[model samples]
Target chain A: MATGLKIKTAAELRTNYLRREMFPTIFCDGCGLGNVLNYTLWAIDEVGLDLDRTVFVSGIGCSSRLPGYINADGLHATHGRALAFASGIRAANPDLTVIVFTGDGDGAGIGGNHLLHTIRRNMDVTVILVNNFTYGMTGGQSAPTTPDGGFSSTTPYGNIEHPLDICELAKALGAPYVARWPVVSPAQPVKSIAEGIRKRGFALIEMLTPCPTAYGRRNGLKEIEQIWRWYREHTVLLDEWEWVEQFGSPEEREALRGKLKIGVFQDTERETFEDRWAALVAREKL
Target chain B: MHTIQIDEGWCKGCALCVIYCPTRALQVAARFSPRGVHPPELVRPERCNGCRLCELLCPDFAITVTEEGRVHA
Candidate 1:
């Protein structure tokens, strides 16, 4: 909450969020996912939140590797069970701010149930999902989020099915907050995710990242810069609704095939299930 | 009066100069650059030994080391 914003040296950014020593994360150059993670960590420190009170959970996928790269308390779990693990952490330590980072396949496909029930319960935890248009870890197989026309190992004939919009699903599931951002839109995404972290109840932020190594090969995008250009043209900001209000739906999402839209789509305050359950089961009340 | 010139357009935004700089005269710019990456700038000319690690390590061949005592095209 300190006043006006200003650009900082990457060195300065590393001091708090990176802790000056814990890890030197291994991520390739020009990878937007790492940049987004760095920005997210910086935003966390910007809010002056107690880092020790934070916990991170992730599932199997290339993006799942993120939780391990971060300085937070990370639990690398099985495919699609990140939400379940995070929920357990939250249920055990209600004071901690739980964050879950997973890939499109892990969160939306295998873990979709955990995602839904986690939101249905509405216990406070922030969800950060990356839709890189395909599964990156297991040799670039087709993911539930892969675009209809995009290429994947299993979709060599060109994916005929449309991609799933995780943000839309979260909103439909009655999540208190839902946002969608691209990896390149660091500033706005960082700010919106900050809001999501401060929010109570369920919050989900979907980021469209570039899998420069795997999906990039299938899509014929050799340079990370090329994929980044895709994000720059297609994505729009929340304040710039004019850029996206006209573009809606999964088919409309294709209009963003070469682009992205970043914003906080939903935000509402609600009673956390954990708090309510605790109060209800208190011995004093009985 | 001769000084090295860094071709910003060819610069790849790598840290070779920042890390290999013997005199600690260089630092990466903090602002968003035109190439959409952090560009290097000569922060302390006094510290430059003109050893040219920046010239050698430039991934894009963006930097050139020029001798102050020589005049050449």
Candidate 2:
């Protein structure tokens, strides 16, 4: 709310939203962390959230390093404990806008238990999980989100285990808002994230980002552009898939064997944990 | 008329903006930046239609498309 007819430039927006001192990010040349951060900032701007009131939190991982680059108050917590730390911050100050950044390995592997309970509680917070398939920061280690038969440092023989579908799990756990989008497309993610930020209860946005140096180099995607193109080619909209399932021929349905589903898995209104806690506090009159 | 601004220090020269530009106005410069990567340059400023696609798709937040009419304090 500064002045008349001021259309903020991207550079201006970056200066206002990000820590300029932290420029020249440590992320590899083709890494998608920059895209994720860029989209998140765009969402924040679209929603007109007060930067001073917002709090960013993250645990250990390549994605976790994002909050430190943001301009707002941030907490760089222990490995796989970002959700726990974010919950504490929200509970202590319910008025603040709390957002947590986490990676696939940090959120779905060691932090899996916390993720379940947090969604079940329906805490008022926004969680952005950047799923790069492998633990990119740790040199291409296989993660819980790594696709079946995907190669990683630990999975040189090909990952035999099935990947964890965090979006489906969050939907079953009753998270108020949940969605997944690959970093190749920014417009959908920006809109979805803006909606998630405006929603009251637990909001989770899982982004499939490229880790060219680590994941892509090992996998078939040798270049960064190949990763984006792969996402574009592999992803199928949920509605389209449903139509294909109900009406399309067996051959047509069989054609979608390895395609990834992308869209808002769940979005429902619910009483948040903070509201319930406030009610109890009032009833007890302590 | 719109002018394209590129933050030389911040750009990693991913060419995402270059590839996504609708007007084909952006191209990676032959000269390297301080970061040793070739930064994208606005080769044909007149061809830019203010689509802001490059602005939105820039991974590093290095590019900004602004018009001549807008005033900033």
Best by TM-score: 2
Q: Model 1, B25-45: lDDT tens per residue?
A: 888889756657787788877
lDDT scores of the candidates, listed in order = 0.72, 0.87
Model 2 lDDT tens row, A166-198:
999999999999999988877788878888999
Error of 2 at A75 (Å): 0.3
The window of 10 residues in a row where model 1 chain A has the poorest summed lDDT is: A1-10
Clash statistics: count for each candidate: 5, 0
| RMSD (Å) per prediction | 9.5, 2.9
Error of 1 at A261 (Å): 3.7
Q: Each predicted complex: what DockQ?
A: 0.05, 0.61
Model 1, range A88-195, lDDT digits (tens) per residue?
Answer: 988888899988888889999899889999988997988888788777778888988887688889999999887787887888888998988776544666676777
Q: Which regions in candidate 1 have their CA more than 4 angstroms from the true location?
A: A1-8, A19-24, A238-260, A282-286, B1-73
Which segments of model 2 are wrong by more than 4 Å? A1-8, B68-73
Superposed Cα deviation of residue B56, candidate 1 (Å):
26
Superposed Cα deviation of residue A165, candidate 2 (Å): 0.6
TM-score of each prediction:
0.74, 0.94
- lDDT at residue B19 of model 2 (Cα atoms): 78
